[model samples]
Target: MLISGIHSRPKYAGLRVDRSGTHHIILSDTPRDIARMVEGLEPAPGPTEVWTVVGACTVTAAEERGPDGSVVRRAFRSRPLMFDMLGHRLARESMGLRLYAIGEEAFLWDVAALARSFGVDGDEIQLDHAGSERRRVFCVHCRAMTENVRTNIVACVGCGAHLTVRDHFSKRLAAFMGVQADAEVRGDLPPVEEIFR
Candidate 1:
């Protein structure tokens, strides 16, 4: 399906939908409302992007006519609903803050909890996952501040889940967000473990 962007973000991400008939309607809905749209369809909300995959569909987001309107679209593969369900389960079980030594063969951080905290509002979760090969590591670089910390976690060339350096830069950010990583860091002046517990 080709989903021409009637109205969307300045930037976009790739996503897949399982259902064959559902329309990829892009409306002027808030992030929270977007979440609500697919909340019950998928039991656990994993990050996902909405794309039309079966037919040529255009959803006109409510807006006044303007000369400089921006529109963007991308192609996404459609999968069975069961695939999404499986991905959600695996994502919940094995995603998040997976770290490793710079050149070590084995994984460093056991990332079950990290996946639990990160979320997507009816869109694809930004975190990357392991691919077929196993020669890379996921790493997170964080910048801490008094008000908020920035975290950037990413899967490596071999496919590993990156940490959210922006979200988990400091213990304070973790604590404020009520995540385990923050709680562990709050006890110590410097972080003993780079990842959230």
Candidate 2:
């Protein structure tokens, strides 16, 4: 929790293998995150599946394969394709699924939201933050999202309002709320810094 008074801010407990889960599904947005994720889950006791957005990742066959060569893994060149496949897999599979995700804040919540839509319980999902600290900001004025924001204040993509990124987070939106920064004074703005990253 970054903000002392805000419970909405997410606090991450790093990924751990679910010992009793019959099936495991692990997901990550970037190569660096997934590499760190595989450590405790390489020789998983049961069937395991790894999904990653491999946009610029260089993956080897051994990396995709379990030590015993039984684990199943898939890489997608795009987030949409991987998300689509994830939805399908969740809908089709009926039992013993434990979902895990490791990546940036937005990516972590995105996976949780998707799993929630599929009737997955919060206790059944685990999230660990990795990679960049950049955030997805939702402009309160226009209800538009500003992706990968690294600064405390940013211009709204839709309404052109200068927004102040708040600690308040919405799992449904998978983003932090951004209110008009200079709403009171027309030209008075806070100093913008690369605080998120």
Model 1 regions more than 4 Å off: 1-14, 26-148, 151-188, 191-197
Clashing pairs in 2: none
- Candidate 1 residue-wise lDDT, 100-168, digit = tens: 111011111112123234442222222112211121222332222111122222222222222222221
lDDT of 2: 0.81
Q: Best candidate, lDDT-wise? A: 2
Per-residue error for 127 in candidate 2, Å, reads: 0.7
RMSD of each: 19.2, 3.1
Each model's lDDT: 0.25, 0.81
- TM-score of candidate 1 against the unseen true structure: 0.17
Please identify model 2 stretches exceeding 4 Å from their true place: 1-5, 33-39, 56-64
- Model 1, 167: alpha-carbon shift in Å? 9.5
**CA shift of 152, model 1, Å:** 11
